[model samples]
Target chain A: MTEAVELWLVRHAEARDARPGESDAARALTERGVRGARRLRRALRRLGASFDRLDHSPLLRAVETADVLAPLASATRVNAGLAREPGPEFLSDLASEVARSHVARLALVGHEPWLGQLAFWLVSGWSVREPARQPAWLALEKGGALRLRGEIAPGRMRLEHALDSETVRALARR
Target chain B: MLHLAQRLDELRAHAAIARVGADSRGVHRARATAGRIAAWLDLGGWSVLADDVRWLRRGLARARDLDVIVESAELAPDARAWFARERAAEQARVVVLLDDERFAALLAALAELPEPRGKHVRRALERMQRRSLRAGDALERAVEPLDAAHRLRRRLRRLRHALEWLELPAPVLRAAQTELGELHDRAALLGALERSPFERATRAGRDARANELEGRLASFRLRWPALRGELRRD
Candidate 1:
């Protein structure tokens, strides 16, 4: 039986420009990205978001963000499967792994497109939810998560928060 | 046995650095050390795997197979491929065995051997130390600027908050507002410089510009706490 799990999906903060000939995996976070991560940590604290585990993409930028936020929550390992471009099969496998492990709440720090797709999968079903022009977040609660088990329609998952860069900047300024 | 001895010697070197106490040392020492090192290597996530015995045999022939192989379930396929290539290209394998006093003595003797080129060795060591010191200094300077920006940002935030809380004289408020805008711009510029490619460049021109910006940022950051404290007092 599948157990309920609260998954907090976070997109990595701003990062340094990718140097030519370097893999995306090697890109490091910028100073602003680091500060943005710290701001996210503080915001999560203020919001009282608690979790049992924290996982991040193996990519340096995502791992750094996860490291910054780990102290605020109880994250055990940084899983690489939660990287950018993780397909539906990978997500299914990950969800199954988490379910088997019985972890109640998990926070994942990853990249764009993938995150939006995962959110879409969780809420809408098969089709990918295109990432908003700006960084945004959706909270999938109740049956909203179950709908992601298969291909479903958009608008099925309730949009909890849609944060743009300006909103994030304002938050960071706070 | 010689190969195993050499591997054990390498393990001993690591143990020395790890400070594994003699009281806990035993036959398992080599295995434990190997296991620890393997774990570290696996965590680095760089390795290649082979499926068939043919490839594995070929890899062993070409690369000196280190006595320990650390494998993780989550290793990426590309990382695994890289590891495979590295193993296939390697010519020697490391063999680790438990501790031996005689082996330790041999390592000590090797260390005592006189340097063939004393002056060159000394100069190289000095250069390495100097480079390390310079890097540390650069890091120290970098933090100063970041801290300054952090403080100014915080102060501006508080002033805005205070403005929201009370009715202030228009001119005084206007002055504070104007100062806040300038501080914000300066903070943004400093942040941009911190992220710029020029910041990472070691060229004299870039270094000079970075140093100047760092100094200014540090000064601002250093004064912020006190400034904020004063504002609180008022």
Candidate 2:
């Protein structure tokens, strides 16, 4: 039997407000965002969590946040697709990427609604097409990250652990 | 303006704490903030402040390097003690740098700089992207691929920083920079370990690690062409 692939979906840290006339992607991380990322890195270290690969969104906030966690991975990549809104294509692309790579452990650093939606899809096979049938949303706060394990399929994965920024801060404190 | 001001305040606060004691995190934050300020200056075309910001960041690099080694590397007690001493020395140097008259001058200048408008950020991104393409061309033509690759890596870093300012998507550039960064870290760590006196066990581990990184670097080099192509389109 093949080893179960572990996927960690991480939301970007808290970003500062976008400057006047600046695009959303231009918003960099705030001081709290930097601290939150570092704390999450420490917390993951405590859990003996290391990634085979880490991919992040192309946005400044996600890139900066992922930079803090780079030491835990052998290599990192930017995934432009990661910045896309949650939908069937996003799910299909992610699933195919995982299946193609066959990475035992992968970490993705991206934005919120997408991260939450991916997690929901993985765990419950939630279909975004049916908005009316949408179950309770699995919301991920800024600086939060969660682990899912099992097959790489849409509904085959299981949520192993979830850590919000605050929880990670507490864990790091210990 | 607010973001810059807030970061400047945070940098000062962290620097003050770092001066009081040998706090690695404080020093790290100060160093990071300095880099961010430099990036902002580039995006804003605040060329006058760029040199000072670069100088500040370089000054903090040594202490940050020592902190990282002390935190991450597995070393014998004797080697650990040696690093601890080196860290103390770096901390002292950091104190002097912070107290320098130039540091005050830089801060005053930074405070007066105007905020970067959207147009400036867009222009910087376009300019940096062009420069990166030239660097890529140089890499292809250079006799020594390794040297050229290193230069390209630095160029890509600046380009990515500019891209970040505009939130422009460049997966190829990001991947290249990330891989290059890891490659640099592994090489530096191996070099540092090799320069130190360690037991046979440590040397063996270092060799194993270096071998692993070397393999990865070779593969990354092989992928560079494809990456460069995608980056050009990006």
Best by lDDT: 2
lDDT of 1 at A4: 57
Chain A TM-score for model 1, please? 0.75
Q: Tens-digit lDDT track for model 1 on B69-166?
A: 11323224553455444443332231211132223332332222221243543443344334433432343456454544444443333333223223
DockQ of 1: 0.01
| Cα lDDT, model 1, residue B121 | 33
Look at candidate 2 and tell me the lDDT of residue B154. Answer: 74
| Best candidate, TM-score | 2
> How many steric clashes does model 2 contain?
0
Candidate 2 docking band? incorrect
Taking the candidates one at a time, how many backbone clashes does each contain?
15, 0
TM-score of predicted chain B versus true chain B for each candidate: 0.25, 0.81
Candidate 1 regions off by >4 Å? A129-158, A168-174, B1-234
What is the C-alpha lDDT profile of model 1 across A133-166, one tens digit per residue? 3233443221111112221123233334444445
Question: TM-score of each candidate?
Answer: 0.39, 0.51
Report chain A TM-scores, every model. Answer: 0.75, 0.90
Q: How do the residues A1-174 of candidate 2 rate in per-residue lDDT, one tens digit apiece?
A: 344788898988889998899777767889999898888889999988998878777677886777788889876655666777667766566667667767789999988676777777778787645444434436677888889998766677899888976679888998
